[model samples]
Target: MPTKRDLLDLQFMDARCKLIDLAAFLDRIERHEGEPDFRLAAFREALPILLSEKPNRARAVLEALSDQTPEPIEAATIQGAFGAPQV
Candidate 1:
């Protein structure tokens, strides 16, 4: 069985992956503005990370962006697309 620290680390990694997925979902939403289902699905994926005991920093950035007027999607360009980071 994994130690507590290992489990926490795995949870953190999962949260990071969820953030990446949220970014992709956001990109898709930007491309197709009419899909509320897609946006809801993305929000569902992101909800865990947002409500986590230790919130993911990247997700926090996106959440802050989502709150502003005109939306960050319209204001600033996202630098990275979804994929596992290079080793």
Candidate 2:
């Protein structure tokens, strides 16, 4: 049986691989000079930072919840949380 940490690691690797593949595919395509694809561009830049910090960051988050308090949130109260709906 895989532990929570083990599953998190697998999911993270899967996500990272998908993102990198997307970036590579996009790079292979011909785009107009300096056309702003801000979303993908930002993702490409952020992926490296995310990958670099992943291990320590994931450990820190998981460590904050002790053995007794296994679940991060007992229950979530979504009432009055989100404000305006995005268009």
Candidate 3:
């Protein structure tokens, strides 16, 4: 297994790029004049998980954004997913 430093050396740039991209995405969202929706709300809620000392942030974040409904809906509203729950 790679050491912490070795892993950072290999992944730092890609991680930095993703961080910057996320910041840019938030910037664009802020610049728009519209009401915030579930997707934005979910994304904001997941942000703190990234900073927490969690062993599995990815799974936590995925669950945070996922629909937790135990039962199926009567019908589909759209052909594709909204990327966030409609709640």
Indicate which candidate wins on lDDT.
Answer: 3
Query: Per-residue lDDT tens digits of candidate 1, residues 7-35?
Result: 88879888789779868976776788564
Candidate 3 structure quality by residue, lDDT tens digits, 1-87: 999999999999999999999999999999999799989998998899999997999999998888999999999978988777778
Report lDDT (CA) for all predictions.
0.58, 0.53, 0.92
Index of the highest-TM-score prediction: 3
Cα RMSD for candidates in order: 13.2, 11.6, 0.8
Name every residue pair that clashes in candidate 2: none
Q: Model 1, stretches more than 4 Å misplaced?
A: 1-3, 35-87
Scanning candidate 3 in windows of ten residues, the lowest lDDT window is: 77-86
Task: Tell me the TM-score of model 3.
Answer: 0.94
Tens-place lDDT digits, model 2, residues 32-75 = 46664544444344445545745675454333322334345577
lDDT ranking, high to low: 3, 1, 2
Model 2: residues >4 Å from true position, as ranges?
Answer: 1-20, 28-34, 55-87
